[model samples]
Target: MLLCGLAAVVSACGEPAPRKTGGTGTARPGDRVTAASAVPVNGGVLVDLPGNAQLLVVQPRPGEFRAFNPSCPHVGSLVNPPAGGVITCPLHGSTFDPASGAVRKGPAASGLAEVAITLSGEDLVLA
Candidate 1:
């Protein structure tokens, strides 16, 4: 019974579903994201873009925004948002920088992929 319980916990924290790589590093050009819609707090908000791509937008400094693909490079797991500003992969303990998307710990050798975006009229647009 204990073994079965452990397996359940492991499976519950398994890797994410496979992602389609159509637009991995880029958001759709001209797509508008309102600031109020994505209130930046610890870890940042998960934004779902067209084509099933996921983005993590973190404002480390006031009025400064950084965006990155939230997928863990080690095994395609969807990295969880920052807890105390540290982005971590729930599956295998990989960690990344929420601001610069740099690799902080392993299992993931590479950092998260950056996604370019620009500010316009209180909204962030894909660049």
Candidate 2:
């Protein structure tokens, strides 16, 4: 009976941890960022990645998606997700274009850096 108890404990310990959902959690290349429905058309969502990186996934039009680093080019402050069709940095009042990641207003001299993502089935995957 000791062997049976030990085997049960080992199996329990070997089980994988539960995966986090929504927008916050560790993710890597080829990992699913979120469901396609989670992002709104003409707006965006912020997704957490491995190593404290952040990805901003946006949809400018139906079935059209884009991703960006979400770090403001001027000072590395995280920008808010698109609202009123604009992405804005809270620290410096910089604004960016949601569709193109272009600098719309500054303190920021450059646009946000773009990240690559692909649509896989019903999910968005880091590319």
- Models 1 onward score TM values of 0.74, 0.76
TM-score of 2: 0.76
Tens-place lDDT per residue, model 1, 1-127, is 9999999999999898766431333445788644634746544777766667667777776778877777789988888777877988999999998878899999899999888888877887777
Task: Tell me the spans in candidate 2 whose CA falls farther than 4 Å from its real position.
Answer: 1-27
lDDT against true structure, model 1: 0.76
Worst 10 residues of 2 by lDDT: 17-26
**Root-mean-square deviation of every model:** 7.8, 8.3
- lDDT of predicted model 2: 0.85
RMSD of 2: 8.3
Tell me how far the alpha carbon of residue 35 in candidate 1 is from the true structure, in angstroms, after superposition: 2.6
Off by over 4 Å in 1: 1-27, 34-37
lDDT of each: 0.76, 0.85
Q: Compose the digit string of candidate 2's lDDT tens values, residues 20-90.
A: 22222366678988899999999998887665566889999999999988878898888999999899999
Best by TM-score: 2
Q: Model 1 TM-score?
A: 0.74
